[model samples]
Target: MAATRACLVALVVALTFLFMEGRVTAEPTSAGSLVQRRREMGSLLRRLNKPPIASIQSPDGDVIDCVHISKQPAFDHPLLKNHTIQMRPSYNPRGMHHDSNITTHAITQIWHQNGTCPENTIPIRRTKEEDLLRASSIRRFGKKMPRSIPHLNPTNDTDTPNILRGHQHAVASAQYDKCYGTKSTFNLWKPWIARGNDFSLTQFWITGGSYNGNNLNTIEAGWQVYPNLYSDSNTRLFIYWTRDAYQSTGCYNLLCSGFIQTSNQITIGGSISPMSTYGGTQYDIDILVWKDQAGGNWWLQVGGDYVGYWPSSIFSYLADSASTIMWGGEVFSPDAGQTSTHMGSGHFPNEGFGKASHIKNIQVVDSSNCLNPTSDVGFITEQNNCYNVQSDTYGDWGTYIYYGGPGNNHNCP
Candidate 1:
């Protein structure tokens, strides 16, 4: 019996040794995989960080590089190799209302503290190695996940209504037969992000085609707080486009070779200073995107400056006209239980002007190239308990909507 007990103990010890040895043997393979990933990341960085005419160090810890307009990343695309840069739009939309009540505070990037880019050059936010590492993978470094755009009509079968995967929104939308453009003024704020990957934004979506068809062409521009993308919580101006529902075409800002930027004063993906506070002086930026009837290129105007254009040759649907336009706040959280990321001012629309975030002076361009105030607007909120939207048309504001909320409050959770 003693000999049998001793044999049992010995067997147990031998099994433990084998398990420990297996774990030890796995470390080198895991280390080798990490080494391979780093090597690939380094190669990608070299291709992205182009030779700059000059570089400026931003107060927000960003490095803005001024590259020659002709040598910008947009030319890297095979489609844009022979593309001639359109200095300005061929036709500017008319019938813009001159609202005297609009303040001219003028939103500018924090990088301007040092200096502005020289003429015939465009400012670009420099990409860093850490920025690539923060992403899920090198392939998706500057690209949003598939199906990131909000679905207009989500089914009621799920617990969360009107949500597209992990994305939530409180937006106002307008649909038309052949809409040429849309414009809005968005109140800026630095909302709280629950996690590193979660993001909050307010932008205009000029969309054509359908997500079901896999040809959802869209152009989005506005301000966002995406720590994972920028590696900081600073409110930065951003632009994004996807010709095929974000599957394999297009990316944010100039990360990929799509949008050709023209403005020397504004840097795409640069931080915007003087964010709006609760019940304080509000800061805002004007975003206008209109298709030039003559050139067929879609032009984007930020504040009073004509930033640049998305060539007509790159898009299949948006090249003609947009069928629908949306404006307002959207938040993204990868957590299954929902993140605590705040949207807009982190207050409900009922909080009103000084306290709530707003997008006012909404307008849509008709086929005749005349911009008109939209009256037929529909507001949709994915989860009312989490976030909501309220709109009103009065005074010079003109069809304004105050939208947003704290993400994981008592009512929301």
Candidate 2:
């Protein structure tokens, strides 16, 4: 019996020793760690689920889908909404009515500290009417037009109409936005309108630049969510730029010479139908436009591909450290009497679901050269009568937004 007991004890000890060894082996090592495993899985998934090269048409009605560029996420890194926009009194007075009429020379002088902008802040430029008119007169179509097409984004404020719903902004703060980049996501809205008149659609402002007492030009870049701007009913991508506050010098992508497009793949004013694609998360335009650290050029990445850039020379304020960045929507009302033309999906931001438009995944590149989530939020707009914005927490998606509304419905006419 004693001999049997001794043999049993030895077997138990041996089994315990094997279990300990197995655990140590299971532990991650320097090279083959959990991070490595996740990266490998991500790469495989991207390859398997890679979207085919898009066949896009140019604004001039040309079949221009020549290159296959992969989709990129909205930002270089995951965007966290840690910081909020720090709006100055002059920028958004009486609550959140940002200077919608900022283009007027009347708003040219900086209201904050006489344009000296306290230390660490950049000067703000308010474009004059004359400059905007000059820029609007010039037209630079990317490809030769088969025939004459009406000019887009009229430089003359009088020429542009506001058939779409008016806009109220929920801007970001520059005090903490010392970040390198800023990005947002939104569902592509399809604005419906009458056949003869140009439908007023949606446009957002990504305003930034250095401001001087003179030469009030701020580099303005953002996607104008316009559909029928080319006179077609299809929902097309319309890009816009204002190197010197919508002056004739800088036009949309590849339209004018100053903005150099490096990639031929991305079709400016490309069509994005069925805006929302289904899989796990809803569909959206995940775009990240940032200034190159060294060159001071503005580069825009739609989805995943490095489409192209706006050279630094085009922007006096953007070429250096930009003092401000505005993210919000706008629509041109061609006629005050006309109200059928809608801005977003023709629904209020509170309408939620498939009806509204939004700019989500809001993030900015910080002074650290990292994309840190911003904090201390401020929200509002000049014309709450037009539309409104609501910030919400979207599970793992972080804080997304619900914005937009129908036109001509609310005592607008």
Candidate 3:
């Protein structure tokens, strides 16, 4: 405990000295030096050591899990530091990642305004329509529209096309190992150099026996070509959820009543486009999503960028915690007879890196709110012919899974 505390202090001191100039360095000195590395490590250890506090049910029949944490987010890249320092227009948890500029007024003022939350409790920052129209072009048209950007990879004649058999998934063991947490992490590969109108993505989800069971919360990211989805056909990070099963409300991303986008770091469909290379260069995207057990909000992050969150007011069972957490590849082919686009990397999970696509370094927030490794992994797919999934843990690759497929093929035939 002493060592962890010292490390946390060292990390903060070092960063404070570097960015103290107020100029965000090209690449943080923290990532370049061994001392900086250890400092970062110390911060991570400190956070993991702290146990999670108990949660409660709000008067609105929602679960409020905003536990108190004295320590601020110690592991964020310098880029996220300044961004998180602002006063979120919505619900703000006690310890939700903030930088050195953090102050008592950051969230207290907003929390104080809400008479709903109990003493010491921070209510979920429910998103208003004004909040919804803030970050998106959807506000311009007054509603959600589709984009024409396609997720198809730019390919060479010599490039090999994926001939997947069926849809596949290499999901972490959430139920089998009885795993539970507020957040999860994985290294996701942006599947490139592929074809098809289908879709491929990796995300976090919690579900009961049925979608309408006790709870079902899904947060997804990847590439897709859907007419019913965005205003375009390009691949993009998409989110979907259902509190009372699909029987009633709950829609994708900010469609209905749930998620709120606070950052312009990612332009929804722009910024990072899908690649079309195979062995030449592979771009793996990092995904991190955690339910602010304290604030009752689901957070989404990619790489060093903190995108936004899904507030607790959007759920019932998920208002507190989830029963199952799934992270893997899934493809959507609207027509059963039409399987085309790709999921994850265009290659199968067995392809490893530089070739096939895969997800690595999987971790989940335990009941204590600390990130922990799962006990095992499980694979599943509707049809083994059109797409498939597999996993490996070798070298820098942590717990990873690869899955994709080519639709209407003999393998699935």
Candidate 4:
């Protein structure tokens, strides 16, 4: 009888803790705990939402703040306190020309329909109080869990370890003696997500160091539809970096202070418009990341604009050059079982173009700072039945990969 009473008390304490953290509704939280949580959230919002010289309300309900480049969040880091922002890359990779024979489609953000941010200012998506409320906690906001990146060259093509961690991927990777940069065009889609906590994304990873240790350095840029992170299901452009394998020291977009923004035209977390429909007109975005050998900063170029860069001083291994480059789609399910969340365009890679999502013209920058087509490419995925990847080469497209699928289907479940 005494043991039963102790268990009941412990359960009650656990319930109270969850309630106070807004993780569960099993019990009502105390007034003091709720007020304290509110205070903490307010303080975080104030720090993130810097004063803006001008603000534009996006059609999709996002407020784009034109913050002065000098006052942006990148300067908040102690390492960057005395850093100077490089307006442009010292040297672009040689042979970085596009094929005139390949037809191009235009892509723009929903916020652009209103107005663009002024020159000498960068557009930042304002974070709201509700955004904080969606997170499991204030500390975990805008951060990916540790080991979020896929394994580098898994021994087996199955990659069962990643599946056990609730992360799925269909990616093409390249490993070289030294990799200075990579570029590709990713097909865009608003794939369905099973839960608010689940996310679907298409991106590329620039990685160095060992994944086994905490020294993994990675710089990532992509479009993701993450409802829990943004408080909505809209697809948004995002960038992330970590010197320590996501254990700490990085965040999505400008939530943290490592990446310096230089582009006035593009908003890091703004919603992307005109998603591709099944068997219809397709829209894609060109993402390019290259290291400036002179300044040692890794620069990010979206289409034609130089978005910003991850300063070389922030990384140990990546301060020199990347060892591997990966491009593909990933889906996250918080549950132990399979989730219904879709990856890529929510269709199998066998469906081909116009139906399946793909990344084309995959290339890598060599030691000589010249962009060349990737050779000896490989693909990996956790579950082949649920999601798969295929690589091929063709005219104008050069090297490309088709990937993604609907999750929790008959074979997947």
* Model 1 Cα RMSD, 1 decimal: 9.1
CA shift of 29, model 4, Å: 3.3
Q: What are the C-alpha RMSDs, in order, of all predicted structures?
A: 9.1, 24.8, 21.1, 6.0
Instruction: Compute the lDDT of residue 233 as modeled in candidate 2.
Output: 56
Which candidate tops lDDT? Answer: 4
Error (Å) of candidate 2 at residue 316 is: 1.0
Q: Give candidate 1 regions above 4 Å deviation.
A: 1-29, 153-164
* Candidate 3 structure quality by residue, lDDT tens digits, 1-413: 78866855765564554344321233334423535555444443443222324343423222323322221221122322333322132332222322233121110111222233223322222222222112222222112112111111124222222223223343443553233332333333444323232345666565433332323443444434432222233444555656654544454543343445545333232213434356755444555666665555677665555656656555666666665666666654334334555555556556665666555556666555556555366655555566676766544444556656554466754
- Which of 3 and 4 is ahead in TM-score? 4
lDDT of model 1 at position 106: 70
TM-score of 4: 0.91
- Report the C-alpha lDDT of model 4 over 1-413, residue by residue, as the tens digit: 78755744654565565456544334235645555666777889988999999999998989999999999999999899999889999999987647568667888999999998999899999998668766766777899988778888465334357778889988988888889989988899999988777899999999998666688999999899998788789989999999998988899999988999999999998898778999998888899999999999999999998999999999999999999999999998875238889999999999999999999888898888898988588888878888889999887788899999998888985
Query: Residue-wise lDDT of candidate 1 within 17-134, one digit each (tens)?
Result: 4335331122222434555656777788877777899999999999999999998888989999999899999888888755687666778789999999999999999998667656
lDDT for residue 213 in candidate 3, whole number 0-100 = 39
> What is the full ranking by lDDT, best candidate first?
4, 1, 3, 2
Query: Worst lDDT window (10 residues) for model 4?
Result: 22-31
Q: Order of candidates by TM-score, top first?
A: 4, 1, 2, 3
Query: Which number leads on TM-score?
Result: 4
Instruction: Give the Å error, residue 181, model 3.
Output: 4.7
TM-score of each model, in listed order: 0.90, 0.56, 0.54, 0.91
Candidate 2 lowest-lDDT run of ten: 89-98
Q: Local distance difference test, per candidate?
A: 0.84, 0.42, 0.43, 0.86
